[model samples]
Target chain A: MTGQSPIVYPGRMSRWEPQARERLVRAAVELFDEHGYDSTTVVQIAQRAGLTKSTFFRHFPDKREVLFAGQDVLCELLAGGIDAAPDEATPLSAVAAGLEAAAGNFTPELHAIGPALRAVVESNSDLREREALKHHSFADAMTLALRRRGIADPAAGLAAWLGVLAFTDAYACWIDPACDQELTALLRLKLRELRAAISSLD
Target chain B: MTGQSPIVYPGRMSRWEPQARERLVRAAVELFDEHGYDSTTVVQIAQRAGLTKSTFFRHFPDKREVLFAGQDVLCELLAGGIDAAPDEATPLSAVAAGLEAAAGNFTPELHAIGPALRAVVESNSDLREREALKHHSFADAMTLALRRRGIADPAAGLAAWLGVLAFTDAYACWIDPACDQELTALLRLKLRELRAAISSLD
Candidate 1:
């Protein structure tokens, strides 16, 4: 799936060489695919992007983090969505709102790179561990957000975990070549299915 | 607290020194608490245990792993518990069984080490990430076990996540010196509370 054309985002990214972060991401993903993740170096990514090694270090601490850019932004989006939800809404409804808030991040550009990112991450144990921790990050962010909205203890935590699960499952489905549904729709469906599945647990 | 008395295990562990793995774990915990996890070296841990560095390596791959021993064994215990449950048991019931099975490892010695382990892990980011991945591992093992029992998708996965949440919450409570309940009882209570919270989600 790695191609020569600059990956473009509809809302924010530019035509060819976007912002520094985009350029770095594009360069890193391409290099990771072509040279193998382990073989690709930060210097090479920087060189491919016409940026200095120091600039690369400024954007990301390490090469493994290049693919995981915007983690904090995604967490902010999830929490912000919940924060903006109506006071009268239920906890899961707020969580659904959080999911919807995070929907903006699932651009077709991210779709284009999903397979390559998945391949690179799954091939390495350290990357897999990082990905798992990412799930925890999302859950923790959403849980704290829910608690702030007056949802208490295990209920808030439970709803947040459900949100993370739905988002993770839907993101996987969206990355699959056979899936036609939008990420938002898939997220809603997955959340509903999980809610339904709760009764089946008994 | 790390003490002069040999940590005793009622079911399996010996009074002092115990097995090589236990000895390594004890030595590592002591060293970690005294020197801080970042400052502690594998050689120091080995030396503290009156063993060579190679013997320590034989028991654990790294210093960080000494505290996380028996992960596979716990996974197996969880799966085996689910396997031994009656076929007619509900998914949560089977999960409760799994938690009960894993409870054998929670000797008073582990409880004694709980606060110290928490302090060491919380003081470091790497340990926190590894700790998060451990939760993922337990959830995965339980998910696969539930699926083997003919539980369906989303249901199996959801149930497994609930089991993980319950186990994690109960673990925290069990570690609290103020709490008097048994881990098994705590697990059951936490599971029920989460199950009840699911309905509130809607």
Candidate 2:
């Protein structure tokens, strides 16, 4: 529901003021976990983050945007990686490069919040739909990037879709507390597994 | 927006009178093409079909339902195919079987309307979101069906997702007038191509 542009706040805040956004996210996740997404409000999230409601609004347009703000950054990383790949790179290779670039954003602290974020998303149908849309948006961005590299229709689309599938599988595995593997390592492993599975298909 | 249950129509019409539903769909598609989806009314669709407004309500709950009515049938076909697969069938094989079963539903007549349907869906963001949701629902149904056969978590989800990707790619090709292949054959070819693409990945 959040339609706010992802522009940085000028003048009053330094570019390094990442704490405000991060704090609001943390507070939203905690409150969403304690109560439900429907019952939580911006005032409560701001209060929990030791900030005012206006400050929360400056960062995110709505509570839903807090959970999804990372998607914009990830899409940019993916597109940038694809654009920076060698001119001779194949469609699948370009997609892999994009995914690898995006993987860098999922730091250990981000992984720590994965489970709670997933739980909050899974509990709400609207959130689930939004998540699916975000995933589609990522794939669409990848497809366009691949096409810019001179890839054809179905190949660009298929490679992009497969890349997203691998990313999703890797994220699920990396979020498990028992799995100590890093996100990049998990992504590679998932991609290999997907290749093997595809090879085994009748 | 359609929330109508799929219960059989009451004593007013025989089960064999599927023409009512088909006519309504044809009328709605025509109206949606001539006018935008947002401007088309259920009463107009019924009128164009030479049926009463109540008859339209009996088949679909709302205007949006007419466009997505096939999804339920496809999901059932997919699940049934997986359920009927041999016990020793691999997860991907089961997924292929499900896709093949669902492919039967895409008759030549339906393929003829593919471009129109795609145009209508692509023109509206709401319709695009609904289409993505339908795609997710199909994947979810396939995953559950695979799990019923004792397939593991990530594997089941991955196989189902790949199957849908193949289906999507194949459908795009099948709908092309220049491409004369049948839907089933196109699906098999697309699956083979996907496997080759994955194999070529580094």
Candidate 3:
């Protein structure tokens, strides 16, 4: 029987030299695209990054963690945003703000990595489950934030899940050259449409 | 690389052996519960059913498929329900009808297998991704059904996703004895609450 990996504290330490970490992620992402996800080994990724296998192990406990670099930071920012929203904003607005705050990390370089991210997510079952778990975590965090604000009949979990899906779908559409809409504007439109669609269900 | 399992054609088989199939499923479910999903093998399951490993494979391609036996059939039924729903019914209502039809497969005996099903989904990333993919397929099926019914908007995809999530959440609540609500009634309440939540976003 295969043993479950020990749980490491996520994003806790600056485990590797910054340059080495960046190189590892870049090389892994590129290799994931070129050779495919299951075929790309940790050794290959480390070698491509010009680092020893030991250094790669030092930075990431496993293969999947490399693909999800910076997720912990994103979650922390989302938590903060949800907590800091002013009294005037609706629950959905607070969630939107939190997501917007997190969106700053989707830099030009990260955006260029979109197809690779989707490919890895699509190919690996574990990656998809981890992604779903992350989404659930964000929803749980949002629910707690909403509960703190005393909003009765908490739909925070459902709302958070829907909002994330909307953002993801809209982001995918916006980034396509054929879509002809900027990401920022498209996200706003998507949010508005999602709100409307939800309203229609009522 | 592992070869894909051969697709079994139903026409080549004799008249449906419901009793044997049911016995096999019962034995598999019991084994899955006692030993956990990964630890249970085809040989053990077959012995429990008083059948052979060859017979078990003849019925199901693998262990995971045993848990997902009704998924395709349910997807088809839900898709058909959506297609046949009255034009005056709201999109939510249509989706709800489809969900009810899908959930119709949940017999009293099947409820006993809930823990094992959830365990399989939780422990295996590949299984989890396949679940997501199955949901995606059902959503696409619903979208096509809605489009044929003359729904006009970018809301088709979003609505299908939300509808499925509502069904899923309600189903989870239903199987938990601690929840103490009838599945049908709980589903109705969930859809109503979901509608209210969606409308509030406006």
Indicate the residue-level lDDT of B44 in model 1. Answer: 91
Candidate 1 residue-wise lDDT, A1-202, digit = tens = 2545445556444444347787888889888888899899999999999976866876789998998897889999999999999999899999999999999987787888888888888888778778888999999999999999999979999899999899989999999988989999999999999988878889
Query: Going through the candidates in order, what fraction of the true interface contacts does each contain?
Result: 0.89, 0.31, 0.21
What's the TM-score of every candidate structure? 0.90, 0.77, 0.82
Please give the ranking of all candidate structures by TM-score, highest first, separated by commas: 1, 3, 2
Report the candidate with higher lDDT, 1 versus 2.
Answer: 1
Tell me the TM-score of chain B in each candidate.
Answer: 0.89, 0.89, 0.84
For model 1 chain A, the run of ten residues with the poorest summed lDDT: A9-18
lDDT of 2 by residue, B1-202 (tens): 1676345556635464467877887888889999989999999999998887887887888998888878988999999999999999988779888999999998766776778888898898767777888889889899899989988755777678778888888988888879999889988888777656554444
Q: lDDT per residue, candidate 3, B95-159, as tens digits? A: 88877777777777767667667766777766775676566667777777777777755566666
Candidate 3 Cα misplacement greater than 4 A, ranges: A1-16, A123-134, A152-154, A177-182, B1-24, B119-137, B178-181
lDDT of 1 at A145: 95
Which CAPRI category fits model 1? medium
